[model samples]
Target: MRLRSRLRGEFPRGWCHSAQWWITGIRDLTLNTTAAVATVVFVGEAKRALRHRDEPRTLARLSGTFEGYVASLLVNSGGLAVLVTMAIEEGLPVVLTALLAGWYLPNIAISATVFVVVARSRTRQPAAWAELDFVDQHAPKYGRPPETIEEYRAQQLRE
Candidate 1:
């Protein structure tokens, strides 16, 4: 029968399609896990850096600003992705999906580039107490005041 021959021809293609889906799922899971671990490590390092109370307030402010920016970008990306998916399901033209992806991909790439620059700059920050004092003097204009190690410890104790 013609139907029997068609089914025979399609059986292997169906198995290949399932295999491709499985591989794609595994790749996504691996990438997600790696990203999660990297985020945890970065947070831990930032917290440790914050423990230096004598450091210029600018460093803290910068870190906070960078973190907030990253968070907002992530939220926006997620919301955009959801909206794109909804539009696709609603039978919107494929061109919309292409446009959305084109817009967000560049934004994400730019964010990542900025993050790298910040991380590198953070590493070069002065660790000396005298440097911190200088930072204190200069940072206030940017709303960053100098904090002393003792003051931070005392505040922690009160809590």
Candidate 2:
């Protein structure tokens, strides 16, 4: 199938001849890449935070850091913000634009405060198997658990 057809019929016939189509395609591609990067960072941060769940302050700081990362990514990358702005420019429905803005504005506020919230946080350390078991509650379907933090770190790094 053609790329134009795969885009949910948003680009009508002969759209390639129009500047709007090029602009929209570029915007979509950029935002999609940004969102994918944000998702990876979010997942990594979540896993790191889970390992440190026993430490309340550390967990909070890690969680806050990830949240800030997401908010900053969104505001800086202009994914949903671009959508709302485009909707307004195209004279789309007020309710639709308002809904998009509702999601966007809070991230603007959040991105502004991320640095203040998580300034001096530390990085992740390997937790014990007992702690991991308590958190995961699932047995490994492979070989034995790591004997030391170094070994566990090596295993995780391999993964």
What value of lDDT does candidate 1 attain over all alpha carbons? 0.47
- The models' CA-based lDDT, in order, is 0.47, 0.48
Cα lDDT, model 1, residue 68: 46
Residues 11-37, candidate 2: write the lDDT tens digits: 445666767667866765654454333
Question: Could you tell me the TM-score of candidate 1?
Answer: 0.36
lDDT digits (tens) for residues 1-159 of candidate 1: 267533442343344556654675566555444333233324433444445433444344432345543653585477568867788688667787777666665555544544554555456655543444443333312122224454354344323
Residue pairs that clash (backbone atoms under 3 angstroms), model 1: 53-147
The C-alpha stretches of model 1 lying farther than 4 A from their native spots are 1-68, 123-138, 142-159
lDDT of 2 at 134: 32
Per-model TM values vs. the true structure: 0.36, 0.34
